[model samples]
Target: MDSATSDESIIAFDKWLETPPGAYVRAWEQACLDKMVANIFGFNAVQIGMPQIDALAANRMPHQWLADIRLHPRQSGTGRAVAVTLDSEELPFATNSMDLVVLPHVLEFSAEPHQVLREVERVLIPEGQVIVCGFNPVSLWGLRQVRGRLTGSHYLPKAGEFISMPRIKDWLKLLNMGVSQTQLGCYAPACRTERWLARYNFMDRAGPNYWPYFGAVYMVQAIKRVKGMRLIGPAWKQKTAKAGVPVPAANKHKESIDG
Candidate 1:
């Protein structure tokens, strides 16, 4: 969060904008994205605040939503895309309408993170899914967030700190989004040409797991809870009743903190 380090991050992001995402990293990201997208049904696939990569993902998986700063000239379905930009808090859709939404570092770069999340919470169905990917504050690659911004874009935050996964989980809990799973990626330094170093399987596992302190990015999947969360299945209760007179009550709260 040093002033000088902040400037450096900004410079780094500028460097990134000058190039596209690395092929290996992009492939891994797309793999994870595909898994998340495939789980939804009759739901909209929304990629917020990342028009370029969202477009890429859309192209890779034609079923995924394709977004852009401007409407796509050739694709008439561009009108179906929820046209939004940085600072656009109000969604054009109804409550509980969206089935899936992807936040590709929008939380890290947004000037009003909470408001954006609130918008997400508003549009999500009770059983909706949201996948978030962001720079890990602790990773060598996460420290390069400033590079994620375009120079002079007011959408970026002015401060810098490790945006801890735990903190994000807490925020989602407040928004009624339950944490389902998390994965860390790019634990080593961001090297475009030196990816040969990660070809070894052992280094890949150790870095993203044990050495997450050096990760470039991390991902989390959260789901909105349904009302009337059941303590026991109906069939289980009937079977247990056949064998016992009473059912013992136990701890009622279960939470995931790997936010």
Candidate 2:
């Protein structure tokens, strides 16, 4: 998609996030994000796009930024003020500068999703992590979205090229980023109204156990690994003992006699 089209799609998606179904997805994503980022220790973190959800609020990182292709203020959610506006494929930050990077629904909307992943990998320090949230293309929600497109009505944003979890994993693997953790949620069927959503709430409870792989959305956490490098603990933990000084034979004999 062209930049103009992409921007429009993102804006529409942002607006959709305020709707009942959009809010439903946002709630699940927010909860997942909070848990995924809470324990991530880092100095710098960046959340790219979808300012409708604060993807890093639970994170304790001292320096955090919210970035997007276009500056959008927080509307229905709490998040950091937009710190930077730039393309996902071309981050302005220096290579290996970020400790954590959050991509919430960015890949699905981007024209060059692989390039975005490459950019993320370039900015992350060794062992630094990236958390990605995306709509699953293999669920009931996915079916509805497809049907919506065929009938000239769209359930999700038309610009979205929904990617499956396996594809995302492969993309990360190519960048030497290993998937460390994952979460799938929002099993409720695709319903426009809040009432119907509530009626199908039972699916949310039973989805994981019965239909584990077909959730509407997924969150993935991957860690960057540099070849032939391993993280070491504090230097004090690996301290070595010093060699003992040698003593003259006469002094050693005298000390023995005294004893």
Candidate 3:
């Protein structure tokens, strides 16, 4: 990946994390992860975003896979072991090691977005889920570039580079990941003054599936692909159990009959 882009991304994310409002942003970030868990299940999950928030809720709602992702000590509710890592470079874990990877704001802020996406692919299991969240350069965040420079938010540079949705999709394609869903947010810069507009419209009107400030960050869930990719399952053992006593799933009770 590009070194310059990677460096920029690291700086941006670190700075964003340091901000006072980061906690709120962190809690709010579960939008994409919640959707991923709702749409897909059965795979072991990995929450790669900030502080590794295992608690996620969105339009679709969080499900079983939500628990599979180990959360950090500080963020993990029950104190489970959680490993933190970056996306612009190779992870310590082996390739195809993760069933699901969440990359929130890790790419847009990074100068080398492709590198981050590639790294995501490297750690993902085949047909694994990848949910990415970032600012929409065309919407409120983009406008924030101007407003930020005016008010000097410090987070935004006076002038610099930005990433777009189409560009992100192209990068994913290059990495052999297919875009399953895309949504925008924080329709505007999402400041304290715009609370009403941000809440009332973020999930419904700002974009096709989301609304304004919609958190000011958007989410895209993609799937890694192999030569032959197929859907996994609905875990319906009862449907097949009627025919004969077949193989028992992970948690089923073992039974036997003796003469």
Question: Which pairs of residues have clashing backbones in candidate 1?
Answer: 9-146, 12-147, 13-147, 137-162, 165-259, 187-215
Worst-scoring 10-residue span by lDDT in model 3: 63-72
Better of 2 and 3 by TM-score: 2
**Candidate 2 backbone collisions, by pair:** none
TM-score of each: 0.62, 0.86, 0.60
How high is the lDDT of residue 93 in model 3?
Answer: 59
Which candidate has the top score in TM-score?
A: 2
**Residue 231 alpha-carbon offset, candidate 3, angstroms:** 20
The total number of steric clashes, by the backbone 3 Å criterion, in model 1 comes to 6
lDDT tens digits by residue: candidate 1, 150-206: 454421234434477777888889988999988777554545454443554465678
Query: Can you tell me which runs of candidate 2 are displaced by over 4 Å?
Result: 71-76, 229-259
Please identify which of the two predictions, 1 or 2, would achieve the higher TM-score against the true structure: 2
lDDT value, residue 171 of candidate 2: 94
Report the candidate with higher lDDT, 1 versus 2: 2
How are the candidates ranked when ordered by TM-score, highest leading?
2, 1, 3
- lDDT-wise, the better of 2 and 3 is 2
lDDT of 3 at 226: 82
Best by lDDT: 2
- Which candidate would rank higher by TM-score, 1 or 3? 1
